[model samples]
Target: MNVIKRATAPTPKFFKLLRNIGLSIAAAGGALMTAPAGLPHGLVTFANYLIVAGTILSAVSQITTLNDE
Candidate 1:
């Protein structure tokens, strides 16, 4: 017996690009946060904010990308 796989729906390329960019930003933010030397209070706060925002954007983009049904 043979079975074939098929996609019931498809995602647009732009959504995939947006998702990848958001994830890359998240990686950059994480690297900044875990620096060997601690960052100043204000800069630390800003970096933390970027991490959070980037994570949220990544989640949203992934959801959009996977919303095909």
Candidate 2:
């Protein structure tokens, strides 16, 4: 019963999407960081936020994937 229960559980597709989105976001943030100075002040803040968010999402995805297996 325990084996059957585990086998019947649905794998989360959302986590894969989250991981991809996170990679894109982090890449965008990195690209933004490479721009020349004199850019808008908020850009850096936004970029930093994206980087952090991406990192978190990627980490969550990896952790969940590992546990799921």
Candidate 3:
């Protein structure tokens, strides 16, 4: 029988997004540290942008449920 379960399942998307963002930030930070302070590029920038957009969309789509009395 199919039954409605918990609201949250294993958040693969979120975790993957977070991981990509974190790695990008780390790479960007490292680049800036050693490159005489300038704008970073490559995967770092792309990943950062994608991460922020994904997070915003995800949050926007979230729905809250009210308990029945």
Candidate 4:
């Protein structure tokens, strides 16, 4: 009897990059929220957008990566 195995494909590189960037953006957004003086209204709005976008990107990356397994 003979057995054979096939190697799986590696994860795409951009997903990892997306996850790291998303984390950094989210952290920056959180830091803005915690500043003592508080950020300007426009900047706060931008920070909120960043956090949302980052969370979305991170979730997408995670779901896609898991599916590849």
Candidate 5:
């Protein structure tokens, strides 16, 4: 199947949960990154990593599909 098709296809329950979690993680990271002064450098770096990891997790989860029995 094509990328679009696979992405739009139905995802498993577990993956749906994972995708939601990933999205939440990304959102949290974004908020952290956008926060005003006083934020530690380490937190900013962690937020960047969170964004990357969340993006990857959500993308992978979104493309997963159930196999035909």
Candidate 6:
């Protein structure tokens, strides 16, 4: 399948949940990273990691497809 076809393909319910969770994690990380209040350096580093992990998770989940019978 082509990239566009694969990307638009139907995803399983469980993977859909994972994709949503990943998006939530990335949003939370973005908020934490950009908060006005002073945050610890370690936390900021963690936030960066969260963003990366979330992005990867979401991408992987999005690409998953159910087998055609």
lDDT of 4 by residue, 1-69 (tens): 111111132335787788788888888888887778957899989889988988888766644432333
State which candidate has the highest lDDT: 5
* lDDT, candidate 4, at 59: 60
TM-score preference between candidates 1 and 4, better one: 4
lDDT of 3 by residue, 10-45 (tens): 334555466456556555555544555454577456
Residue range 1-69, candidate 1, lDDT tens digits: 111112223345786687678787777878888998978888778778878877887666555534434
Ranking by TM-score: 5, 6, 4, 1, 2, 3
lDDT of 6 by residue, 1-69 (tens): 776776799999999999999999999999999999999999999999999999999999998888897
The TM-scores of all predictions, comma-separated, are 0.70, 0.68, 0.35, 0.71, 0.93, 0.93
Return the candidate ranking by lDDT, descending: 5, 6, 2, 4, 1, 3
Estimate every model's Cα lDDT from 0 to 1: 0.68, 0.74, 0.48, 0.70, 0.94, 0.93
Candidate 2 ranges with C-alpha deviation above 4 Å: 1-12, 66-69
State model 4's lDDT. 0.70
In candidate 5, which residue pairs clash? none
Q: Backbone clash tally for model 4?
A: 0
lDDT of 2 by residue, 1-69 (tens): 354453445436887788788889998998888888766879988998888998888766644532443
Candidate 1 matches the true fold with a TM-score of 0.70
Error of 3 at 54 (Å): 17
The TM-score obtained by model 3 is 0.35
- lDDT value, residue 11 of candidate 5: 99
Which has the higher lDDT value, candidate number 2 or candidate number 5? 5
Candidate 4 local lDDT, residue 12? 54
Worst 10 residues of 4 by lDDT: 1-10
